[model samples]
Target: MQRKLAAIIAGDVVGYSRLMAEDEAQTYSELRAALREIVEPAVQRHGGRTFKYTGDGFLTAFGSVNAALEAAIDIQRGFGTCPLDLRLGLNLGDVIEEDGDIFGDGVNVANRLQAMAEPGTIYASASVVRSADKEHVARFRRIGRRQAKNIPEAIEVYAMHPDKAAPNGLARLLPARRLSWSRPRPTVLASICAGILVTGFIAAGSWTERAAAPPAAGSTSGSLRATAADSRPTVAVLPFDDLSAEPSQTYFADGLTEDVIANLARNRELMVIARNSTFALGDQPADIREIGERLGAQYVVEGSARRAGDQLRVVAQLIDARSGTHLWSHSYDQRIEDVFAVQADLTARIVSSLVSYVRQSEAAAAVARPTADLRAYDLVLRARGHHKHGGADRAALLEARDLYGRAVELDPRYATARAYLGLTYISEQFGWPTADAAELVARGLAEAREAIRLEPDLPLAYQVLSFGLAASGEYEGSMRAAQRAVELNGSDPDSLMALAKAQLRFGAYDEAVENAERARRLHPLAPEYYAYIHGQALYAAGRLEEADEVLAECTLRAPQDPDCLKIRAAVLVGLERPDEARAAMTELLRREPDFSLAGEEVGRRFGNSPLMRRFLSDLSRAEAPPSAA
Candidate 1:
């Protein structure tokens, strides 16, 4: 027998004997599949080898104790929805290796520990706990000293709880570093340092400092001039750094960043720069002032994410862009599923710090609960990212729709996912090829109605319902749903945008412009649709020059957007710019070869509205083709 120190891992399915007795063939097949698909891959990923398999259990060995613990955690998390419930145990000690098996006190202790672990949990011996990195150690929740059968000495044990507070040693280990990363104002500096230490990323030095303290004068005078001139307190949230030992968690970090951005965009009083612009900054060192100036943001939010076993820690800070001073900071240690709450908390704090006199209701809207099902929520977020990146990739939209479908399947009560699925269907219906638009709109309305029925209080459900209703020509219902959505979450950019569109279709020109402007303030980096609606609303109200200015910006921002081009053509015609009007119409026809005033859904929706009449007359004057006229 060869003896050496090793991390021994043992796992057993709960109620295995009973399950097999009840359905021998089915239970055996499910267990075998899980071991093959979930357990084996996790073991291999963490550098562990499964050396033995019991009828309903497995024994694995790893050179590093941390690897064994992590693999155990991964297995437990994966099995949360599996047919079998599993309890894992890990111990670090000298083990004897024989012909084809590992055996010793370590194996015995691991088995004993497994018997004590709760289902869906990993329990580790003191030696295993001590072997982990400090950051990993911070995730350990002590299970206390206990005596095990066949063991002479009492052993200390720990269980991984991702949602719990950090260990005491974490703060002691971190240095009292000053504002090298960036200065926080006096009021929040201490809290910021505390946040860094609590997140466990401080020891790894996962943050970067700018090369220069303040950006040079005139550095933002070029393209940034437009962004810089916006009067509202503009803000950007850079992508959070992923500090997880496993590379697979980078997506989780990205999702968290998106959630933060989404939350901030709910505040109608703040000008939140869109994720596309901030994410362009990437994970590199740059002057905050330069970032602020370039994005035309007055404030910046930056953060880092770390995951150890089942525990997750996120540290975030808000900084004043021009002064390089941090305004607020916090650390959240929670179960991975509670990430949405962390984002909500951080957004509310940042918004409060940047803007004064934020209404309690407005603040509440910024943190409205989306869903309680974490897995479903994750799928929805992933789908959102895919939808955003779908630009010309038809597959991306299909994949997003499938993901959203899966999310709702996992949790039938996940109203947010259902609502988003409604939106995805609408996008598929109207965008690109535009085939099956009518059929898709019918299906989308069903999804929207179902979402609203599932969670009547959810603002997003009503927002999507409004879009579906309007597309189906249920004008009265659409207007009512839009109004309800706005009343429920008046500060939400998406809610306001949806209401604005419904209002435009209803020919409530002044109200549409008001809502569109509110939406723009909430999302300064909004898509062309918001600007187009505002411009069209102005035109409907006979504010021709103002409409011209807005439509020009809309065309500049999204030259290819059919609606923007359509509005631009109308605005140019109203301004007596016949040449520009012709050019816009020509471009619009190129994108939509079948383009005609009579062929548009909007024209039908606003059939009796003056705006639609003027658009049709302008189409004739452009003289592109009889089809357009």
Candidate 2:
């Protein structure tokens, strides 16, 4: 048995047996279904290992105390307003492993902690508290003392108050970092970092840095110009509130944000947060510094939109995340039909003032859509939301696909529809029965490119092209399309995430990690997919220990995931626990007999060759494997 100190976690349904007795069939069904959907995935996301799947609950193992607390919080959040509740217990100490089940005082303490906990609460021992660097950030308060059965001493406990406080460690920090909305003094330090980051990569063998992000640039400025710490460039774009009651005015607001995003991206000398990340924070009043720090930016852009009959109004502001000062402010009122012209003209002016030598190719695409396509364009925007922003189970994608289909049917030459259709294909692949990865994907991608040809100026064309390319495994091509998409709309988190994944897959390991870190910060609640890039980045950097921890997390955190189980097997093998590794492998093989050792591949897919290398090296190191042989 491997002797190791670990964090043990115990959780159980608040009233499982009683609920069952009340309505055995319905209650059991709901509990089972919810456990699989919400509880299990949350545990995995918070980096917990499943030691046992209780008939109605779970006994989890975590290596890090912080991770254990996080898992509990996530479980609460994932339930999302549901009345279901869970009780949690956690302790950090040495535990003996026997046939994969843990033993000793640590496990006992963990179980006791849960048994004493109230419904919907996480109770952790003092040992777990001391291990945390930022436990206070989660608003977990000391809960006096308790005596556990057979425990030598009384233990101090802590409980998370998720309802009263922000549920995440980082989200808790959001209130303090406000951005100004009326001034115009944008910093350019981030742009320097951006430049240095890009310039560092002009090589045939470009991807060099592996462990951490660009070594903090000793570190490079986001604007790519090295500077003293006091002066750095950063920006954030706030969500534009729609003031119109009809809700139809949303497009005008969304369009404004998109336009501003382009204006920001055009500043080659400045670092910019991708729009998707910024808009994510716009829905609520957020701490700009926290948002900027996480988004990897120095400034923020925020605004609201309203329409009264033919007149449309948009109030926009850009704020410095660090200083909480507004760098610029403006308001526009125009006819609804003229909103397109408003975005184009405003973007053009903002560019002429802030950026010199605006690219002609971009300028051409910035033109407002013709008045004839106004109503149809709204459907396109709605389709965009459905196709991209929505999650795996979001039904909106079907409606989006159909709408885009109709939009093109109504206008055969509409390049946007073609690109959108391509985007929809990528969305459909997330589900098994509804998934059509081959034929539909090919046609969708072809249409994306045709959209580009027909509408070279539209960012959506590039965005769709990027997603199609990535979905098709054209990693390098996808990176190019994604890069172009961001160049066209730097504030779009979706584009950056797409770009980040492409870079990770194509061996641009360093850049991939940097961009992915940025994307994760902007969209912390990224449904399940966030773990993919985060876990891969850890693995690529040879952080196998950490990667194993994260991979185990994916197993439950990501609902209905094929790769979660597969990834666990791969990372365990990397950690040299062949027994645990094989167990994971056996489970995967049950799901897929053709499963290969290539799962060990970090940046690249490992085939039989890497497997042979690993097998030989491992056997050479293990006296038992040889003695048995």
Best TM-score goes to which candidate?
A: 1
Local accuracy of candidate 1 as per-residue lDDT tens digits, 329-442 = 889999876766677678778866765544333454446566777778878877877876225567888899999999998998888788888887776655653668888888
Q: Please list the residue runs of candidate 1 whose C-alpha ends up more than 4 Å from where it truly belongs after superposition.
A: 1-236, 245-248, 264-286, 290-298, 344-372, 389-392, 432-436, 601-607
Query: lDDT for every model?
Result: 0.70, 0.59
Q: Against the true structure, what is each candidate's TM-score? A: 0.57, 0.51
Q: CA lDDT of 504 in candidate 2?
A: 61
List residue ranges in candidate 2 displaced over 4 A: 1-232, 247-252, 286-296, 345-372, 433-436, 457-463, 466-493, 499-527, 546-565, 578-629
lDDT of 2 by residue, 522-585 (tens): 3434445655555665555566676666566565565345455555555566787878766665
RMSD of 2: 27.7
**lDDT for residue 127 in candidate 1, whole number 0-100:** 90
What would you estimate as the lDDT of candidate 1? 0.70
**The candidate that achieves the highest lDDT relative to the unseen native structure:** 1
